[model samples]
Target: MLKQNLSPDLTPLRHAHRLATLYSYEILDTQRESVFDDITRMASTICRTPIASITLIDAERQWFKSEIGLGKSQTPISASICAHVVLENDVLVIADTSADRRFGGNPLYTGDPDLKFYAGAPITTADGVTLGTMCVLDTVSRSLTQEQIDMLRMLARQVMMHLELRRMLRLSEKTSDYRARMLASAAHDLRQPLFVASLSVQSLLQEAAPHQLKRLTLANGGLETIKKGFNRMLIAASGHASFTLAELDDTDLGDVLEFIHANFLPLAERKDIRLSVLRTRLHVHSDAVQLETLIGNLVANAVKYTEAGGRVVVGCRRHADHVALHIIDTGIGMASESVNTLFEAFRQGDAQSEGLGLGLWIAKRTAEALGVSVQIHSVPGRGTHFILSLPLKASTEPSSEPIVQVR
Candidate 1:
């Protein structure tokens, strides 16, 4: 005997939560794939039904992720028999939709290519959320045999498994791409400084005693650059270190900015660019070392790109609930279009620019780890600004520490 229940019980809150879970899969409105199409086709053939569909119940619509002989991509949820199947979270076998009180008045049942029979197995996640159904429809009233019902249920599980697999595969591919880009950037950036240090030492050896002092100074400068490059590399590499949230401390933002100024000032001077920091008494919740690394990358990048007489400013602005740390640089600013790729590893605004272009990428990852927001604004030939918005640590009071000048 076919189970009969036209109007399935569902609560508004539960349905809304189900919709949220469905959206998280990101499967709605996507293109059809052979994996799902194969399942629907097989379901139709196995059940001896002319029509089969892999339906997804969205907010107000029944979308066909895959269909065989349905001849339609979607229909209103009100007109869908599968919507009831989602609520049941089990196989729904209606021997005759025309006789079933729940679906007899449904337009899909009375219209052309009339649907008289339906057998649906809920496509459910392991977490017990029913996304939709894998259903077979027929024009003539008929019941699915016990064996056929079991097969349909197995096929529904396959469909859900495929959806999960697809999502995992996509995530894996993205992670792999990210790792590749980071490796490429690290290799290129690390090589440049080491190469420069090697060449500086070689040139120093060839200089006469009278010019040895100048050559030695240049060699020392190259070593300093190498050390700075390694520092950036080490900070970026150590980002994956496991740390408990309990270890998070109240960080003085001003002190971190001062350290960035002191460290980058010499590099800025070498380029004949000015590096300045405007002191602020803002306190934020963050790890001091990680915060320093994040700010260091920004300051280094600013000084690296600015012209000889350009200025790079580091300051903080307090908002209602957060503090914005700004790294403003009068450098060769990037085009609006290029800004989108700035945080992508190995991507550079100017292909000829020094380093591997991973500074912003590292900075972005660090911000994410620290639970902060990073914003960027730039204009070509003018300048760029990177703002890191950090949540205020209300428990800590701001300090009246004197501003540290490194210029």
Candidate 2:
């Protein structure tokens, strides 16, 4: 087997041609299964070879995805006899390794599990670049019957079909996962508005008294809460819906925080908790829709976990290259285990919280995509704080815009 380094510069056209050929197989680092294994086993039996391998040659190594009677999955490309087999246009056979000068003292023959005989067929895509070799090995020097050689070629064709089918199946699974997420988000959004309207109507039917008026006020507040929940769900679903970046604007961070304050205050008041914003003069280049969703989830979570009469604060600090906004709450903070998975999709620290378990996950992903970063700090019995950091300067030209603060 000749040892030639396949460098890109050595033959640019040839390298591109080979890549195209390998791509046609659509087999890269894919999962293994019984279907392909069965074919290898059958091929080995028919050929009467003690050891057989289905090997794919990568940049640095000859990789066996499935092998019978072999423990190692890889060997350096320089040492592979199959490397020579791939360069050939047809079946490569060594009638007897001991008799042939090319392989008589081959290291593989002198080392453990000695190789005395070799036979292989090239696994070439339709474009004609050999991606790898389908081979059988023997410990005793011997020649294969012509019928056996033909069977090996037929099995290689079946391997190519198996690779193609697996790729299509994986693509289908991804599409199905995407559709299911959309449906779940829709259900989460619709349940809120519908629940609020029902509750408002029921409150109206109660007797007109002091307690009744309080109930009415609480019900109206619940309607507002539902409105905000609907908005955030839309934000999260939109992020999942697209691959391209969305339109951004010079958004007022102060105004965004103020709006979230208005929505969360009533919930905080219901529990007799204090909610206040300590910073108001900051500006950021961001998507207004996603920025709103990010802050809203943090504030809501603070209120949800805090006990009665606890304090929750939202503030922003100015740094050299970035602005950091934090929502700190004296609440029932999560344990380390829960916090680790806090931003994972469909994970919940408290199953009782009003969410589809995607708020923090969406917020984390949306902030990152918009060139912002988020941090979380918490103590189990004390509280939790969410810090959002955004670059002071946009990736584009510096703007002369001033930071605005609303008291």
Candidate 3:
């Protein structure tokens, strides 16, 4: 390592990109961490100094993340002697401040800088952006051996690793929160459909009609989708990983559509809407529960937006290499401008909209996780259409009995 001199460039090392990179760790002004305190204590022990600190430099100040024998938690950048370490590519050492004409009366945290000694290794990022330093100082004039200097550099590296690991955990927690919110919103949307199923069950118990019993069957299937999807989401959140559907073995698209139709049938009927599915016995490789969820959300949105007398249909057609499943709704379609931002979370055509505005966004995310492509076409005052292109991988068909509610 280069032993740097006191001749600092004097230019503030406040480069915007470098500051942004340091701030990415989200460690500034946070509560004191025991791990960092331990490192500083070890540094003091190894170098036999009265003071040691782990610091971070922002634009205006150098804040001590961890320190021992330092009375102050922070000081302005101009007052910080460690601030010069950011300008050095390697460790900087001043054997005796009293010998240096400019530092004869400088104020250090120990309140005795007349003849103090300082040694600091630049706390550098993997790409070599120096944030601050891991440093030790003494009121008496002294210097560290080459071995002690190398050890100080090693401690600097350990600081960087802890910062990196902490950043990753925080980012993972944010992603898990996002996915959990999506799942909770999705779970909220299913309640109305599920409640309608309960009503249908009551009618069947009173012997109102045989079709009433079919609605109950649809509710049962939808419950399975919720159970399986919830478990998958919990697993993803716990691991701080993205929601994945690697278990796409073989799924019956017909069965998937059948569940969608059953789940939303009663909701559509209450609004005097005709909800129907055009059946196809197509087999595709996908996660069945998540596939059903994607289709279910689209179908749910279709029923929600369509007028009382309008119609929403679900169907599929074969292409050369994939199957195009369609969700067509004759309702109050959105403008082209609104269609562009439909998949962004919480974005809606009307600010006073009815639902939470997560349906289309959830649909979009689910499609991505399942490796399905979604296309939307809509025009104001007419209708909206959704197309999902599923990968072509047909296998021996799964047993899918017809639902009575499908026309």
Number of colliding residue pairs in each model:
0, 1, 0
Model 3: lDDT of residue 265: 93
Worst 10 residues of 3 by lDDT: 398-407
RMSD of each: 20.3, 20.3, 19.9
TM-score (all chains, Cα) for each model: 0.43, 0.43, 0.44
lDDT tens per residue, model 2, 30-136? 43445556667767887898888888876566788678877777886656777776665478888666666655445676567877888888876555667777889
TM match of model 3 to true structure = 0.44
State the lDDT of candidate 3 residue by residue for 1-407, as single tens digits: 21323434546577888889989988898766555776787789879998999988888788999888877788777666777788766798988766665453345523444327889999988678998999998888898988688778877876775575455435544574445544455444653354335434543545546776676667656665664564454345435434444577778888988888788999999999999897778877688888987888888888888889998988887676777788888888998888888886545555545543556766776787678999999878778888899886754334343323222
Specify the highest-lDDT model's number. Answer: 1
lDDT of 2 at 399: 38
In TM-score terms, candidate 1 sits at 0.43
Q: What is the Å distance of residue 271 in model 2 from its true position?
A: 1.3
Ranking by lDDT: 1, 3, 2
Q: Rank candidates, TM-score, best first.
A: 3, 1, 2
* TM-score of predicted structure 2: 0.43
Candidates' lDDT values, in order?
A: 0.73, 0.67, 0.72
lDDT of candidate model 3 versus the reference: 0.72
